[model samples]
Target: MAPLLICDNRAEVERERFVPGTPEFRRASLALFIASFLTFANIYITQPLLPLLVDEFDITPAVSSLTVSLTIFALGFALLIFGPVSDAVGRRPVMFWTMALAVLPALLAPLVSSINQLLLIRIAQGLLLAGLPSVAMAYLGEEFSPRALGLAVGLYISGNSIGGMSGRVISGMVAEAYSWRASFLVMGIIGLVGVILFYLLLPPSAHFKPAPAGLRKGLQDIGEHLRNGSLLKAYSIAFVIMFSFVGIFNYITFRLSGPPYNLSPAAVGWLFLTYSAGTISSTVSGRFIDLAGNRVAVILGVLIALGGVLITLLPALWAIVLGLLFFCFGFFAVHAAASAWANRQARRARASAMGLYLLFYYVGGSFGSTGLGFLWHARGWPGVTAGIIFMLALGLLLGLTLRDKD
Candidate 1:
């Protein structure tokens, strides 16, 4: 065999590929936007409910963190599988159907009688949820032109930011007003709505190619992509950003709920609204990175993130909220850039590369959420803040090394 054709047949297909401004393009973008929203919202719904879990289960912070961490951990492993599987089968089927299946676990969450049962249910949902992110990244690379990739990726991420905000905000308010169970039910219903819309709206993949079926070939393809230095560096950025991001959000609730501030759950949930900055930053950052270069864009994003972390050290509520705003923007900015860059680099094994990226992304998240809880428990808010800033500093260093200047 002549070194197996990768990159698929998309170049020939690209003559008629979806650009940024066609009816088909608009529909694809909208569908992906909705898909991104539903995936992220479902994944993070348990975050704001952590305090309630702590109280109800009488577990330690690290233990309570498991609800989110274990799900992410499961998601991490599942990404490695789902992405490759989609490569062999098809993107459309994998993207929409797995999402539909995930709603079952979400609906079951509220009905669980014990923490263990709830955790098990969440873990199952996490596994099912993995098909969306990796497959979606691959779908973007296949369907859109390089010119539109950055902006399209940004739009997708903006949906992610908003979905995350909605989940935190809605869950917190519902949990505060009624109960955690009520919040889970609400998220399940919302997820179902998004799923239906995604299935109906997303235009079929016009440029997709089916990879060889089986786990062995998928692993081989994944291994080939992993050896690229630039891709590996991009993967590091994914891990660091997610580690710092998820860990911070995981524990910030603990600080606010128990502080001299003594904020209510609803009020704490309002803090996630700061994520709106991400909505703007991700879109602008993508367009900017497309025009400028990845090096400057990545560095600028990391610096902004560092500034955000430093601001949280201040002792005022207004200052904390502002810091979170900066943090949200910075993370989403880098995420849009890095995710686009990663997809672009794969040129060949796009799905495999995306799967690997998310693998590190969520695995790092799993570790950070639980690992940082020790800092939160031992040394309090100041300690947790320092740890995150340290990770952000590392991410900044890695960001400086990216060679993809497109």
Candidate 2:
């Protein structure tokens, strides 16, 4: 028997979702896109600064990496709380306050006298970062007409690509010219601007019905989704993709900033322009996914990503950048396809399924960004690359094992 979809109003929930080319649809998409932009930008802006942090704080490369890792780790747990809370209260209120409150910590980050104090602020910022991603998907699920959803989602994801690239470029440049503290200040300003625009643009939720806000109910709901074999595969895929991607980006900066390459921080930041390749690949991959089937796309993406990892092992700067471009391309493609696959398997339980996917995603990233530091310390960049490739291979194998009916 199929599980029931809980909602406050059946008629409202069952109504045809939003269609493309409408004014209201644009507003919703733009708002969500901006939300994605701010969250990703702020969270990852620290990537290029890892080397700078080691010098400033007199910390080891591994310890300096925690700024990104800890931020991502907090985001995972926060998703568990906000997903159910948004179900009960409302999406806009939760999203709005999360964005607003997150800004304060960013603003305060520059004021922190100790590294621990900065980490505390990052934790709070990461927690609030949760309000958008899962809820935004839920919002799109309710609001978009099925035919228009792909484009709507594409736009939202585009923001993430551009935001991540711009954040690193801007922060790294600012840190180079001034100080790393100034980089945080710039990121905080950008975040503030994003919140204002999001508040003014987003439409109120009409189909959103408050589910009962209870921890027990949310846990039970998540448990039910976990029982589905296909859903579990979707989750494991997410875990590996994020784990491999974060670990690579975290250490690449360290490698490039060292001896032979001797790149400046801004130069390291420029390399992230490869993320735009992801933006392009994600869009193109989406078109092929409906025809090629999700599994085929996922397997190819993992293989492509792994190939990129291998290219980075070469001793050429241009080759490294080219590798990263391919890596980002594969990352975005598989993510778009795999996420859609998971939601399809979950059927009516879309929100909970998304929450689980995100939970795995960040948990993977947190560990990837932090845990791989030991390998980096022991065996250099080659060790980190070996670890990431192993994870990618596992993900590819899991992708192959997924049956349509599972």
Candidate 3:
């Protein structure tokens, strides 16, 4: 038997075989985007609510953040399991089951009367959600045309930004108006709807070949990816960039609510609209990366984000918002470049590589956000800004160091 090969140019492969913009491809991409958005939204819903949770649970700022931290931790770790499982099983079935499982926890979360229970459910939710991202990337690698893959991936990421923004905005407002429990219920319903749409629309993979399942093979694949210098640099870039991004947001509410700013919850909710800038930047940057290459685009993105952080130092409220918009724009641009670079660098087991990248990404969010909460607690916004600046510097270094081998 001939060794099966996953083609890099999915568009040409499909054109030689299947019709372009066929009902199947359109449905699959749309369904996957919806599901991706819902999963990501649920993961980030707690971000804007950290202050509320601190007051409600009567916990320290760091502890209160565990509601989000633990979820990302579980998500980061679960990628190891999900990546290989999708390779051994198949993308559609794994995605369907994982997404269905995710809905249950969101519903169950509102029923939990205690913070501990909520935390437990969130961990379970993170583990299940992990199945989607890694498998989704692998699906694109196997199914899309190389020329078109960048756009498809960018759209999926745009769904992530939209979901993240919606989750924070809606949850913050609902928590202010009703109770936090209501926020959970609303997201739960959204998850259920996403699941239905995903089932109805996601087309079956025509090109996937299941790997032979064994622990040794899985470990070897993972080790091979880790050994690649460029891939390792991409992973580090993801870690530092996400760490800086989440750390800033984790404490921004605390700053606004307490001091000279003293903004209301609804007012704070409006602030997350800055994420819209991220959605636009990701799409534009994706096209830019294809044209200019990852190194230049990523370096420019880091500088933009670093400048945005400096804007927050201004005492004026409008300046702060402007700063946030720039920060989000830079973050998304850098993220789009780095993620695409990872996909292109891995010659085989691309799903595992992407999963590893996300593991570092979210773990950076978890630890960086929680650990930096203390900086805000001790020295206020200055301390938090200083921490983020350090991360951005490291990210810039990594971006500059990136090299492609022909």
lDDT of 2 by residue, 231-269 (tens): 899899999999998899999998999999889999888
Give per-model TM-scores. Answer: 0.95, 0.94, 0.94
**Model 2 root mean square deviation, Cα atoms:** 3.9
Write down the lDDT of every candidate, Cα atoms only.
Answer: 0.86, 0.85, 0.84
Q: Over the full model, what C-alpha lDDT does candidate 3 score relative to the true structure?
A: 0.84
Please rank every candidate by lDDT, starting with the best.
1, 2, 3
Q: How accurate is candidate 2 locally (lDDT)?
A: 0.85
Q: When superposed on Cα atoms, how far off is each prediction in RMSD?
A: 3.7, 3.9, 3.2
Candidate 2, which segments miss by more than 4 Å at Cα? Answer: 1-16, 404-406
Residue 121 Cα positional deviation in candidate 3, in Å, after optimal superposition? 1.5
Q: Supply the TM-score for candidate 2.
A: 0.94
lDDT of 3 at 136: 84
Per-residue CA lDDT of candidate 1, range 115-206, in tens? 89988998998899898997998998888887888888888889999988988899889989999899889988988998999989898887
Which has the better lDDT: candidate 1, or candidate 3? 1
